[model samples]
Target chain A: MLGHLPYALAAWLILWGLYGIVTSRNLIHLVICLAVLQTSTYLILLAIGYKAGAVAPIYADMPAGTVAVDPVVQALMLTDIVVEATVVALLLAIAVQAHERGGSLDPARLCALKG
Target chain B: MLAPWPVALPLVAAAFLAGLGDKLPRRLADAIAIGAAAITALCCALLLAGPPVVYWFGGIQPRSGTAIGIDFAIDANGAGLAVLSSLLILAALFFSLKYFDKPAHMFQVLLLVFLAGLCGFSLTGDLFDLFVFFEVMSAAAFGLCAYKSREVGPLQGAINFAVTNTAGAFITLSGIALLYSRTGALNLSHMHRMIAGHDDSLVLAAAALVCTGFLVKAAIVPFQFWLADAHAAAPTPACIVFSGAMVEAGLYAVARLQGALFGLPQLRTPLLAAGVATCLVGAVMCFAQRHLKRLLAFSTIAHAGVILCGIAVLEPGGLSGAGLYVVGHGLVKAALFLCAGMLLHRLQSIDELALHGRGREVPWVGVLFALGGLLLAGAPPTAMFFGDGAIHHALEAHPIARFAVTVASIATGAAVLRACGRIFLGLGPREPDAPGGGEQDEEPETEAAPIPWSMWVPAAFLLALAIGSAWLPREHAGSAAARMLDAHSWATQVLDRAQPAMPSPPPEEPLAKGLAHAALTVGLAIALALLTLFRKRLPEILRGPVRAVWNPLAGSLRALHTGAVGDQVAWLTLGVAALGASLVFS
Candidate 1:
């Protein structure tokens, strides 16, 4: 139960980040909040896959062929991290361009694009 | 070996084109895109000829009924989508040859990546892998949306698209994590096998979250505002792909998930309600649009809602209807958008009211646009007629829902007729005296060239396919439906046998129902539209109390959308917390 604390904490961080993203008026802050949310999700995913008393996945002193935490979730988390980074970078670029053109990062002024 | 190439080929082509496409000749880059899509289409055709195959990566295998390796599986549905994607890409590329200016290579590269991501999204067997592909597709779409950075609308549209879509991705990923925690498997089929009868509310919450991501992508109601703006702001060829094929990826995800994960009875009601609301909202929104491209965008959303209704039914016929609608709508919408692009190129504006009576300037384009409009209205000898008819007929088994779908289809048809009337029939502000006066009016200073055959050929081919698919014999249609059903294994087989052994229905059933509905709805719509067309009556109708009631609702909704970043974030955050709470509680 104590070991699962990290997973709960990660989930909480995700919620908090989501709160920040929703309440913040700045585009940069929203992007940052999204990144934080993404990080928290990845952490939660990785934490869920961890097993008690399990050594590092790769270690010389570990029991030979002993079962460890599932590797699938770890791989998924890593891929997700890469995906998140790419998405965040792209979002940041778009936000920067929007700011340059509109002179305001407030989404209220961005209505120039809507139907 | 051929299995993975359908996805990998395009990815490689995308990378190569991005790196060196700009330096290369425009023709060469276009050729590469066409070649890659052609190969992918061929691969899909070959796959369709065989039974479903699962290709495992890294040599991992299922142990104790758990899938430990990544898998890409191809069944009838996937093959059908592959074909649809390839065909749309081919058409977009064909049209882009003359439509675009410089930087042709970058456009082609992004197109290839978009294709690759779509294929990956359709074929991947793991939930997390689906997320990966979803991100790939969304990111590529965002890039394509902003590719025309010289334009302010495209830049702003791309920003809004990125934020909304990114938030959606996060929600989807969170759902995946939760599902993984409950089931301890990533493979979708394995998860299905494991969770089939398990009454875990957590899975339901995850399903809702996962579905929200696709819903946003699909541009269903409440999430549809972004679609019109994005579609209107995108480059013509990009709009073709965006409206034509990209949004379908979202519907595809929802359909696939419903088929695999949420087959339980409890989930069907909410799904159907959402589908119904989307259909109604989309249809109404279509009537409210003034821009040709934006009207098509809303119409596309309406049809997507119809397809969702088909999916909500969860019957074999319903699934087949949805499949048919997806393919049919993709082709017809692409053609419509491509035609709209040509019209816009010639006229430099998208307002139908502004471009009234300009159709005759480009005679062939005018003719094609009219035909495309007919198809959009689901006239006989179009695939949408059969697909939509089947959905309406299937809904007949549920008496209460049938009226709603019938009304929605009628509204959809009427919306198309309204646009067609304005663009093709109404008198314009500046009527050109000559048959070829469009060229003179458009660019009087420069010599006008003939509309390119490259553009006409693809649009004609797609229209032909749409007509031909509709004209296919009922038995052949049944066989195609059978292929979709065959994927469900025993349930499908049992249902097949249990189906009533009455004499086969005539091929004209769908045609008859569609025509009847179209006539009734179009007649009513025209009557109402005619009344509104008289400006004096419009003002009288809008006077005093009527105006008072309408203003506040519009103002409130408009206020809700007041371009405030905080408000958008607040909604996003509220949605996330609501979803997260649902996950935890339900």
Candidate 2:
């Protein structure tokens, strides 16, 4: 059970980040919270696929690959990270523009686009 | 030969278009999108004509290996969805030509990418590949959602959509990881074969996780906050794509996964419960909204919930009903969104009051909106009515389930009726002075010339498709349903034997019942139209309190959008945690 500590920690971080996102009023803080939550999900994924004492897929110390973390999860995580980075960047740019146009980053004031 | 190109071409075109989109002429960019879609549609039609062909990437055998390479399986189901998607994208592209002002290239690029994602999602056989396509679709959608970055609503909506959907993608990836660990395969068909014989708790957990991820994408009850904002904030063309095609992809994933992986009886009850809850919540929410686009968004959620009910039955008829509903709703909802866009372009507001009398000005749009509404409400001749009826019949064996479907149908009908009453019927308080020929003449020349055919054509085409697909032969319809039911299941096998004996008209049966239903539906439609004509003098009792209750509910739902970045994150996190826990526990 202790071996799964990292996975548990990741879960905790996700929950913590969610709490921050829900309670925080600041747009930047919300973005940061989302980033944190996303990172925790990645960590949970990586931890789930982890095999104790296994070397990373790239190392010479891997003992001819007797055991290694599932490479599929690694590849998926890598792709996911790239996707996340792009999304965050685009979102921040949008947020910056919204701030400039609306004169405030407060979500309450961004009602110009409401249904 | 043409099978693989439909999915592959759009992907390649998207990359090329995105790179040269800004550098190229607007006409070239638009041509790139429309041309790619036209070719895709042609390819789908060709595939439909041919036998179902399964193209294994790198010649990997299916259901026997680790699914190292991706597979594109072209069944009737895939072909139908592919054709629908292609036509819808083509329509959206046509609309974009007139709707967008500048950055035509960016618009085209995003549109192609979105199409690529949808096509890839529909065709992929590998579960992991589905996740990848979902990500591509979602990321492109986020980009398009915020494409109009100068506006706060678009920005906030995009951010909310990104945060939630990205997390959804991650959870799905995690579910894939768990499934891989348990089954050692990435292919859906392979996994389905393995999972049926195994009862490991981990498989259930993985299914829950994956379904949660999909539910978020599908905008099911609790995870629906981002949809209204994103759909409402997006440009009209993007809105058409978002509502018409994109949401269906999520439901498609759900149906595909349920049929392929968790067809177990134990899973059916919980799924049905979720579907019921989603329908009730979504329908009630739809009734409360005032903003036309937002109302459409909530209505989408309600309809999706109804689709979920069909999915929960896990029968061929139910699956077929769900499939038809997805296609039908895609067309009708897209048309409604585009109509709303047309109204907004001319009237400058989505407020029901603002759009009150303007319906009289744009008779064609008004008629189309009414048609779209009737279709959504499950009136006959339109596809949703058939789909809804099929769902009702499919669930008849399960009383609780039947009751749920009935309530959802009624709610859906009432919501549509209410919206029509408010928008077309003039039951709501009139705008003190509407713009055309009124005190608002001081406003800039808001009434543009009637919308061009490019904008109207796609919407009209979709309407025609919705009506046509509803009239498809029962055998052809039965086959699509059978494919969805996983023919190997005992439930399906029994249902199959009973199907021929059932009342679905023998092959020799004339088109009389269909035509009669159409006539009855049209008569109801005309009566509603007449009501709309005399709505102003109707007693206040019918309209007043109903609007009063609906306004606050809609307002409160909108008010939940505190615009706080944190709140959005919080909801996303909760959603992720719930998904993760479900996956872990199952």
Highest lDDT against the true fold, candidate? 1
Clashing pairs in 1: A22-B569, A22-B570, A107-B563, A107-B565, A108-B563, A108-B564
lDDT of each: 0.69, 0.69
Candidate 1's TM-score reads 0.87
* i-RMSD of model 2 (Å, 1 decimal): 5.3
lDDT of 2 by residue, A25-48 (tens): 566776776677678767866876
What are the clashing pairs of model 2?
A21-B566, A107-B563, B205-B586, B288-B554
Please state the error at residue B53 of candidate 2 in Å.
3.3
Going through the candidates in order, their DockQ values are 0.48, 0.52
At residue B265, candidate 2 shows an lDDT of: 61
lDDT of 2 at B542: 82
User: What is residue B233's positional error in candidate 2, in angstroms?
Assistant: 1.5
| Candidate 1 lDDT, B88-168, residue by residue in tens | 888888887877655477777788888888888888777888888888788889998887776556776776677777777
lDDT of 1 by residue, A1-115 (tens): 8877887787688778767876766778888888887887778787778887775576577777876787777787778888878888888887788777667676656554332
Chain A TM-score by candidate, in order: 0.82, 0.82
TM-score of chain B of 1: 0.85
Q: Mind giving the per-residue lDDT tens digits that candidate 2 earns over B243-292?
A: 77777778778877776666666557766766776776776666555567
Look at candidate 2 and tell me the lDDT of residue B1.
68
